[model samples]
Target chain A: MAYSNAYAPSAPELPESFVEQQLDGENRYHYAYQYQPTQQFSSSSVMFPPETHPDIVKSFESADRDRSGFLDESELRQALSFSGYEGISDRTIRFLMFIYKNPGDSLRLGPKEYVELWNCLAQWRSIFDRYDRDRSGKMNSTALRDAFFHLDYMLPTSVLQLMISQFDDGTGKNVELCFDSFLECGMIVKGLTEKFKEKDPGYTSYATLSYDVFMSMIIPFIVSYD
Target chain B: MAYSNAYAPSAPELPESFVEQQLDGENRYHYAYQYQPTQQFSSSSVMFPPETHPDIVKSFESADRDRSGFLDESELRQALSFSGYEGISDRTIRFLMFIYKNPGDSLRLGPKEYVELWNCLAQWRSIFDRYDRDRSGKMNSTALRDAFFHLDYMLPTSVLQLMISQFDDGTGKNVELCFDSFLECGMIVKGLTEKFKEKDPGYTSYATLSYDVFMSMIIPFIVSYD
Candidate 1:
């Protein structure tokens, strides 16, 4: 009675599911800042109750409850299980915590933060594409360092410092991440900063270097002052 | 020092990475699996490790960390991240979690599960060679149900109970899972019970329905339970 209306197609249903040979089977999919389609798929298609795919659109749609485009987390949490990840699992959501809970504040992913996230994600695909050097279609360690190095990231100073220190462990053959490691390190730092700092203080160019490098590079002037 | 010993080549080694199909451009393979050949590949016809694609071998070798042959959670966690999952982010990892965790237990996918996954994958070759009944290269609900009803699944009571209950919801009037879901669900269940159920549930012909009937009549049962 309930989902019947929610899931059943209001539009003219096709004789079967879309015949895109390229679609992963059953309209199944996941959410990610990814550059490729997955391998999992099936031949089965549907002709009715056509709520299908990427699941993100579905989640957003469900959350918009009244058919409005905008969303709040409460509404999102209720209707969208998203196979188990709800809003808490969304990248835009995490980004909000970073934005609103400015180190001094404890705000959640507010509307303001949400807008910034949308802006970033809209362009993140192209950003990720540019750094994928091997052209394998993904941004791994090298790709990550390149993005951070060439582009402007709005990260905090402390996080930036950690980036430089953690990656440059003495031996400097592979100074910057290739892509894979970049994502790993970036995410780890993001997680820690969120839990401890409570907000993003912001990032610096020197954030790419460590304390020792900072001492040799920036301290010459600052320490002299101290 | 550790990696040095492994590099001694007994034969020619493939290039550190895959030879790009230059004319084609690797749009599809940007995030496909990477293989790196650590040891000098003795001349082989398969991967051309000693001469090329050694990196592909290397990637697989890295993923199979323990040399366990089949990838486990840790292995999959690490391996897939290289492809773009960013270490199974909550967004991307949701679908996998659903399949592996199902109703109970953290699943350890093995060769059987792997093969089924492959079977369900979309191919450019033939959609209807045999799998599709309507020449659509895709399966309609009836065809899907018929196959399911007939499988020799020694289903757990909970799973069976779920299926029967779903029958009551009536999604099965004339519907079936696309090829991929069908394989994933059936194969995982079969693999679990037959290969890893621990208790070794025996197959019972009596309880098993025909694939035709399952697609036709029992799919609603599955929907309700799910």
Candidate 2:
């Protein structure tokens, strides 16, 4: 139930200037720093990069119950939950680890990586809020298309229809996606495209895969999201 | 149970010449026409292209229970099972429909498209058999890699590891995949790749997608496979 209510859409709408700043690219980070959350964190001993928000640091320190200065899979899961990312899948966590974890370390996220992850999540959070125009905590197919178009994905209409149908709550005639589902969707696209690029370095839009290798690469993303 | 036994690996290995001919590209179809199944079909009123295999024709006729020339989703599903493709997911069926159904039609497959589908499956079946050298009804990570490599998809070890871990039966130390699972894996890779190519026609390997569009495109493949 906590996870269900994780994105209850209570935050005030972002001002028009904030949207313009986000479009200006470099200024987006400036706005993220300027934007303040209603919730406050208690002061902590942990020293992070000056750019790292205190809220993020508090969330991380609280989740790192062992205080190992590193967050393993379980700790990372807890950290995400504390940050309002509920029901985070192991695959998504691994994907986050794949992106931000230290090169030599495969399973743990150091403080720097944790900070980076928080920033990335914040950026995505802004994108989600921008498109959920009704502040209903969900977006219909058209809005979903506009949101992705704003991101430059240019997906086919059929593909868009398939997505809404999959996540449709069934109570309504229109397909609607909540914040958590939107995050999962974003990560899968980002993750798979990155993986595909490894083989298609030439950008040929064509890559051949053996049955098993293909299965192995994709099954995690597919199964975890389900 | 029949689906489980679908790829029992009882067929004799392809002769060296057949492998060489397959590598020669155009000669592969000639060989397909020449290769004969032991099972025989009785004389039938239905006429087919000279190139079409009688076994394929027989399978199609049997699955077309209503004597309709075209196969709807359920009929197509039954036809695939009759052709040794069992446990086929609805998503995959929709995918097949997407590929083979007529331009004006969204659901049914005419005989021509059905034949093309059969040929495509046959090609995939050979590919599966070729990589399954041990014929234990499964392939380990290395074999999976080689199989994909043969198909020109050079995926990273991390991706392959993730995939195997996903479908791993847990009863064994090593991950192994059966024919049906292999089919599902290949379809996901092929399906997602084709979808990605639509947006990345320039083959830039960098296509932007909105969270929702990305989710819609991928969720189908992911959920159905699971």
Candidate 3:
């Protein structure tokens, strides 16, 4: 029930008219943030809006059950996962910590440091929870595949399979994902497709970057900062 | 007053500590969506969540002054502009209409189509408003320039000038942007930077892309869809 309420509106309920259009094969509905296979969105230079940090702090501190004044990685990960990043991975979570940490405190996150990371994670959670239909605390592989397609990605099944495997919760079942792992997968696909779109701006809807570019640009961000 | 209240919490309110960090030349905090000039985020294949659409409809219909059963371009533009996209242009509004319109009704947008377009514009507005610190309905050149930089772009002033010009509202004053114009600018900066990162994924805070990508991938998206 907890997850269900969180995901109650996952498929942003469109009016019947639009749904009819979709059923009639008129896939004309396009979301502004809908990932375009061949287009890149401009990045904004402003930092997170100042007012949202408190709610994040609230959430972070609330998740800090022991009141340690800092959230250990696992606690932070658990907090984020339950809050909506159901499929994010340990690796991606670490990278997030790496990118958002305070100067002296590398491993544990203070409230100030945690707020910054929380802002981004919150956005990711909003987006992630939107597509997490079953609310089973994980996006099953089939659902994961659909999520990508909805974002206009056409990844190969093998790649999708491997991605799910990386975040498999060791349940002996290989198809579902938690928030951290899901975020990791989304980031990679968005990152690569964004690149391909840049190179093949002719509306190819697909692009091929050099291996060098792939290695140099796409790989480092995801591989872990440690 | 309503709009102001709505916007009051738009920026994540950081505690004093983070503010101190920002003031003290410690720009250590970073957004997850910060467009890295280099590096790729793996793409997650998921569609936009459906629940968020109704709130969009409520906003859109509330903005419909004449109650024409649809939001004309200007009404739509005004709604979105004041809502958060302070410097959005007529061209981008039209393009939004084009991308979100029903097949037969190209000129006027009903709540259904408007909700989809509103979703993207709402996002643009969220990012745009955060940078409109004064709430002046415009971001001056310095602010606009900083907005791009914050998104990790290092655009040549010439390119920035051209971009500002294209979306200029023709007020004879060229130093600032309304929501329409600002949204147009943000799109280009984010689009190109996203691509560059895919190629130059090193730790460079800035990267460069060809003019061709700008003209193709981004330019088309913001131009009039009509």
Candidate 4:
């Protein structure tokens, strides 16, 4: 395959399995990460859902605190909060802004950009909601583990504890996860997972690579914003 | 668990499964990455194989081309080449040197540091040998992906292609992986896989974490050298 400045190829058409609906939730989760090609960034490729849902528009308006017809980082955070997400750090908000912001415009998200952001957030929220089970506004460690497992990452438990300790808002003994934190974890794991799969043109959901190939080549891009 | 500057608490005692003899090669591969805890970095914590293999000493001496009683980056590359490994880029060699070299002394590897680097490289070599079934000196793409799969990463094929293309000796169509490149890829994937499992306290092969928890706290370290 030709290497281009484009970080990823165009978002692939939804695969047969996705359209066929044969996949269970777990399989669908894996399929989404494993099969959905990493999206390339270009103004033309900024795919908004065919039509913005009314709820999304209303939520976006609510977040437009100044009603400037745009959503800045703060407004994006507010919108996420209004939609029942909390604990989103400024860094993460900025990252989404960087990813979705229109070409040559970094100040704020116009309505089209806002809808794109809103839809993606909603998708992620639904993922979080599925595992929150009790809807307690926070997820315990088990819920968190299952959430990732559903995404097909069967990571070890100690790593999870260390990960949780990094953000567990409760007193020392209690471990809980809120939506924003979950979103952050999902993004990194999912993004890396997709990058790992880029070699599998065969779509066998697997690839073979050596350590040197990853470090000198893949990791820089993983760390790079540009 | 208490958060400490310590990367990993003293390497947990090798698990009983490792001590038991029933594990097949694949199972052993799984055990090393999936069950083996991520190693921490402390000078005192550096664990060498109980005894130095004679081959390591011989190779180190050869790489000490000038017989200065130390191995610099160029020497390290030659030594690795002598051990049926070649095509290691200078940058990768330097990174390993920086990783394993003693803090105050960056010039070269003395005998002690040489043994440590030798042991780690030897372990990585054995891993490559398992996949290079033909002893052809280069691994094809399938071998590369299976190597990671054995280490518990189910990365997709395209990612593997992107990874391989970076180091593929082939002009445009052929994909070949020599040992040095494999070692680098294995190290990063293994390291990241272990980090992913760090959250799993139970050793149940799974953990749950939120994106915010991971991004705000863990990602910087993932991308950072120190």
Candidate rank order under DockQ: 2, 4, 3, 1
Mind giving the per-residue lDDT tens digits that candidate 3 earns over B1-226?
0011121223222122212222212222231222122322212221222454444555565677776667777887766754555445455665455445443243566654555566556666776687899999778877887776655454555445445433433232555777766665565444334444443456353334432222122222222121
Arrange candidates, best TM-score first: 2, 4, 3, 1
For TM-score, the strongest prediction is 2
State the weakest 10-residue window (summed lDDT) of model 4 chain B: B20-29
- What fraction of the correct interface contacts does each predicted structure contain? 0.00, 0.18, 0.00, 0.00
Q: Global lDDT for candidate 3? A: 0.48
Give lDDT tens digits, candidate 1, residues A1-226: 0001123322112111111110211111122212132332213221112222434444445455555444444554443344243333333333333322222222223222333333333344445556776676545444564464444223333334334433432332344543333433443333322221211123211112111111111111110000
What is each candidate's DockQ, to 2 decimals?
0.01, 0.12, 0.01, 0.03
Q: What is the per-residue lDDT of model 4 for residues A104-136, given as tens digits with 9 covering 90 to 100? A: 343467666666666667677887889999989
Q: Pick the candidate with the highest DockQ.
A: 2
Indicate whether candidate 3 or candidate 4 has the larger DockQ.
4
Across residues B56-128, which tens digit of lDDT does each residue of candidate 2 receive? 8878788878876778878999988988888766656755654455433435776666777777677767888
Tens-digit lDDT string for candidate 3 (A1-226): 0001122223222122222222211222241222122321212221223454444545665567787766777878876765555555555666565434442233566654565566556655666676788677677888887776665555555455445543533232655666666665665555444444445556544344432232233322322121
Worst 10 residues of 3 chain A by lDDT: A1-10
TM-score of chain A, cand. 2: 0.63
Give a tens-digit lDDT track for model 2, residues A180-221. 667656665555554444445555544553333333435545
Give Cα distance to truth, residue A55, candidate 3, Å: 1.6
Candidate 1 regions exceeding 4 Å error are A1-86, A90-226, B1-129, B149-151, B154-174, B195-226
